[model samples]
Target: MTAASFTAGLRSALRQRFRTLALLPRLLHSFWQTSPALSAAIIVLRLLRAAQPPLVLFIGKLIVDEIILQTASPAPGPTLADWVESGRLSAVAGWLLLEFLLVATANALARIGAFVERVLTERHDNALGVALIQQVASLDLRDIEASSAQDRLQRARTQRFMGNQLLTSLLSQAQDFVSLILFVIGLLSYAPLLIVLLLLALLPTLAGEAHFNAKGYGLNVSVTPERRQMDYIQIVGSVAESAKEMKLFGLGAYLAGRFAELADKVHRGNRDLAARRTLWGSLFGAIASLAYYAAYAVIAWRALKGELGIGDLTFLAGSLLRLNGLFERLILGLTQITSQTQYLDDFFSFMDLRSTMVAPSNPRPFPVPMRQGIVFDKVGFRYPGKGAWALRDLSFSIPVGETLALVGENGAGKTTIVKLLTRLYEPDEGRILVDGIDIRDIDIAELQHQVGAIFQDFVRYHMTAAENIGIGRVGCLSDRPRVIEAAQKSLAHPLIETLPEGYEQMLGRVFARGLDLSGGEWQKIAIARAYFRDAAILILDEPTAALDARAEAEIFERFRNLSEAKTALLISHRFATVRMADRILVLENGAILESGSHEELIALHGRYAELFALQAAGFQ
Candidate 1:
């Protein structure tokens, strides 16, 4: 590589590595946020534990020296018990007892540190999970649907997998570092060159570990989209909703086979990286082992030549062995930290993304207690990444207290309009106005609250019947009476009454003993959500597609009564349904092709009439 390119590549790698470690402070802050007492305990305990290894080794040396001195002095007693009783072994026993106490105290401190670390890990994981939920909830639909976003999300999700590992590695590495410093000091007193030799031998191993860790991180990022796809396939094959369809289609084997193939691909990539890492690691480990043995011979010769005493020889050798082991462990811990930190970058980077749909700093309230109603004034929007506009120059008015129906075939921008109206997305050009004011200036929360909508793809939450409707107005989720009232308005109360638990009955097949409703029944339950909402502009985006003719009529009848004082926007392909609206707009190719009453459109014999006649012929 040329100098510029090489420098850029190195900079990129360093930047990525730094980004990975950035999560460390954030995680520590989360720990402190979780429990200050636990945080303090962890730090103090790690410090105590850090000193224990050196203390134990030094004490062992003292015990050996004491034994040698006592042995030379000779004992008057013969038997072991007699020696103890006559106090001949008292000095040696005291030395041994002291070493034992130091070891015991260290073990206790280690256990306490582990316990506090474990608790802190759980708390940080839980806190991050909550933070993730809040962030995801705040994100627009566009943010969640992007493939790049999904990959980033997958990487971020891996953080939970490393939650405990990150904490354990960091704290353990800290303790080992302290032990290493003390060992170096003790070793320096005897021969400092051994430490230099040891580092030279271990450099290859550390370099190998770091290189492999970077490779593993790179593979993880590359395979995220594939991994996410595999997860989706698994969900569809095994989950309750798709179970029936999967069984009917015999897709079980197909999905499983696909999953296996994809999983094997990921496994092979990981194996290849791991195999090379292991091979290099073994070679470097042998090199380190050779250095240690070579140093051992020199220490032994010095002791034989009387340059060092027996106690000094023992302490130096022991310290050399410990320092080598601790240094190796510290390097391995650091590599592991680097690898795990890459996953953490996923989370922090994902959280850093801000939505462009944010409201103005000084926001206006929804023109609540409305006047002119919502107007799409020279508005245009194209979904992210799509070259063509989903809706363009779509000027229309949802006049206050009027039932405005939108008619369009699939991909004709029906739902896109609803999405824009609800501020799930913002227009790329022009603006949407609420009353006489631009919606961009309105408080996002207030705007959303005033535009209660139930899209075609609304969630079927695995919750109780009451909760399903109550979630629409979270403030009244616990208000049983309001939930029942909303259910009654959507005509779901009667269906709910037929259930074993009435309003308390669980919905969806995801949960145990949860009842699954038919399409029409589900439609009723979903409509209840919009009914429960306190929005001034009610937007129903093809939410009644599953309902039968009579049920559709009854629901619309109720909708009419409830929406009399509220502005209503209905989107549907059912021609029979659109006839009830005060006015109808025919949308084609992202623009308004026709705007009039159903009778006028039918008389005009335009696209609206053509489509109406086509569907009308279906009954014949």
Candidate 2:
């Protein structure tokens, strides 16, 4: 309502208009790529449909003129049969038949065009969906995890649903535009001033539509975060994953009330816009209608003065009436397009995003038998939007075939180290070297392929037991023998064998025939994935936190044997698991406080010994 705000909104709308205009070509290119034949077919069909209205109207005029000419005949036939018998009414009959044919053809064209457009829109939707997924996948881990990036992704996803509809609207408007041009030519030949009057009458309507459309877009952008929250609440309230907790805690009513509050806010915003649009729309419509009648009055008076034929009067009247409606339609359609283009802007902008992480153009291959070891040299990192560092001045190394255990409490930079090793987050300062070469020199994919990791919060995939393990080495998903071997190593084979379908049985409760596993059982399945990888460097970050003492001991024994020839990193709070490592690292606040064998640390009575004693006391 303020002058400053209005001016700002106008500028924003103008910018959006220009940006969307730039995106139009890209949209057309996407449509063509989806299916060139279908795209061309739709355009040709619309063009044919556009030409039909003008031709049909012209034929109707001819039919009227023929009837009037026959009616004025001096020796007219007295009966219908007599008229048919004589050749006097042949011209009228011919015009009538031509008009019938044109009408039939127009109907057929309309039906076919609708069918073609439907098919095209469906194909385009599918194409856009695939592209969206691929684009998301190509983004960096940092971008995917950031809150701002998620908002952009949500907007992009919502826009995909509108893409097909926007396509249809654009093509339909193009059809209408062609018809409008033809109608304008028809009017210009007779009364050009009527066209001017119609345009003037609809100016206010056009302005109102543009302003409201811009306001609607702004409202949508502002409510995106709330809309995302509503979606999350809906999922939590409806899905099976949260059902048990929701029932036990009686959160159902709370969630429902929260959702309603957000929904009402959104509803009020939309309702206000709709009410304003309706009021202005009706008033503008009345003015347009009044202008149409005024134009008709001029034509009627001219006909009465014998300046124009009865047929001319009829043709001009019909054309003017159609032209009036056409002008209104064109204005409204153009505004709809300008509004829809904002969504197009969201989608194409998403597509334009490029990841910042880049690999060497000529990268070194991964070392199969890594020579020296892995080293982190004075590495420092801080998470986005955080002032405090997650890891700082962290320097450590694991020699070839050595099992290093990292002992750290929560927020002690244990998981952050793993994330850094996997190149999920780039260090603010320092270098990670594998085999004495900077990891940046090696291809990222190749580096990752050599390091296999299983964290505490591992994924419980809703797939078969074999697939859950096999996903770790996707190329070997069909290698049943390898999958079984990995499962056996992690003590998961016995658990899976007891299931109804064994390896083929689905895991997790997301599907109809799925069987959910307990926390300990899921941990075993997750550990199986790291074994399945068979990489040179293995990382187990509290992977057995869910297991019992006996189970944990059994799993670690097997891991020790399998990793005898492989360099590995182990992170666990349990001293029982930590004692087996070749070297123990006592980390506090992102820096190593002490390093030694378990016996040596126990002798020193440092942070490690103190933590070990505290854990040992719990068991006593």
Candidate 3:
């Protein structure tokens, strides 16, 4: 290859491998801003730790030299009387004290480094966790639902905790490498051969560690399915909604068996890998031990032959031990970093996901209170990877100050209509207009702010009663009076009143002092959440499914009163609720079959009438 081409290829490879490293500056900037004092302390402690090792090695060599001179024959060396008279004993004792001081200083600095790193890591973890959750919240609804996007999100959540540890470990390793180099250079001046022997000893351990790390990462990657299955089992076995069915249907044991099978598969794979690693480690360990003893024999022979002093032998042995520890730590740290790079890849991939539905560069402002109604003009949409359209060339308008109901069986695209109207999904074929302006032109945040929706399977948050309702308007999540008012509006206040702590009562059994709510009560809480939003456009999808007849009727009546002069869309299978809507649109096979008031639809005797009669028969 040409020199330029080779250089370009190398650069590209590095960019691919170390893309997350490129983001380190930004990550460090955030850390500095969040905890400047802790960051400074870490840097100072690391520098101190780097400086202390060479000082200790220098003091060690001095002590060794002093002992050698003192033990030498009386011809050139000072006699015991001369040594005492010259205060040489006190001088040696002072040197030993200084050496001890240096050792103590090194240990203290290391402890300080650890403490600072721990504090910074915890702070970074909390900040990143909150940031990720907020990013997920801010994402467009359709983007959040995309399978690839969700996969990235899951990966990010998994790596977030470990990412902080990886960062701190990298910093510590860098500092330790500096210390190791200085210590080795100091030892080289005393015994060069010992350095060579120490290096040889480290090679086998380094090789074993590298292999172990690679195997561990491979095992993690291969067991993704087993891990996901185990997680699914845990959720099904623990969640309140699934608990009843799990027991009644006798699915608990079945799920437990599946979980055990997956666990066994993972355990066996890990055990096999560990056994191989152990074998490699043992073989290398034997070689390393032999090399060390050979080096020891050479030092002892040199000392006996008067080629080296006894104190020099002691210094050589001590340096060899320290070198072993230093090299092992260096190799282990490098392997840890290599393995953690995969986690960093996953974390950055989530943060960098590209959205299909991009916001406009210059979005139009959404007028407050939505003076006009919403219109769908030749709207069509297809989910990603689907061959057919969920909604095709459909046109409809919901006028202001009116209640519109969409009645359809499953898979008739009723929910899709609400999703598009709320701008959760953009139409591929045509435009949806809000106040006569294309929704694409409006600010996404503003558009979402004007809408409130309750899905068929709404989330049952494991939080306090007030938080469950207040989260609907997250910006005002602590507004107690507003939460209470919303709860009252949805007839959930009575349920809250029965709780021991009223609004402060925990709503799920996941935490201490938590109480589980019945399905009907949870429905009321969800309804209150929608009510708390107080948006201009409201959508309810099977919101009354869990309510008793009396409660359902009362809620519908309250909804009717609350929705007066407001634009609302209701999706329900209950004929009684559909009858209250000013107009009903009957959908079949992804197309509108009929649209009229209840009486008009009954007169036509179309799909709407047929479905209505079928439901009415249930009541009879």
- For lDDT, the strongest prediction is 2
The estimated TM-scores of all candidates read 0.96, 0.95, 0.88
lDDT of prediction 3: 0.81
Clashing pairs in 3: none
TM-score, cand. 3 vs. native: 0.88
Collision pairs in model 1? none
What is the TM-score (0 to 1) of candidate 2? 0.95
Tens digits of per-residue lDDT for model 3, 496-588:
999999999998998899999988999999999999999988899998989988899999999989988678999998888889888999987
Please provide, for model 1 over 118-221, each residue's C-alpha lDDT reduced to its tens digit, 9 standing for 90 to 100: 87888778888888888888888899888888888777777655766777788889989988998888788788898899888887676666666777888988
Tens-place lDDT digits, model 2, residues 126-241: 98899999999777788888888888899999898777887888887889889878878876878999889988998767766777789998899888888999999999999888
Indicate whether candidate 1 or candidate 2 has the larger TM-score: 1
Using lDDT as the yardstick, the better of models 1 and 2 is 2
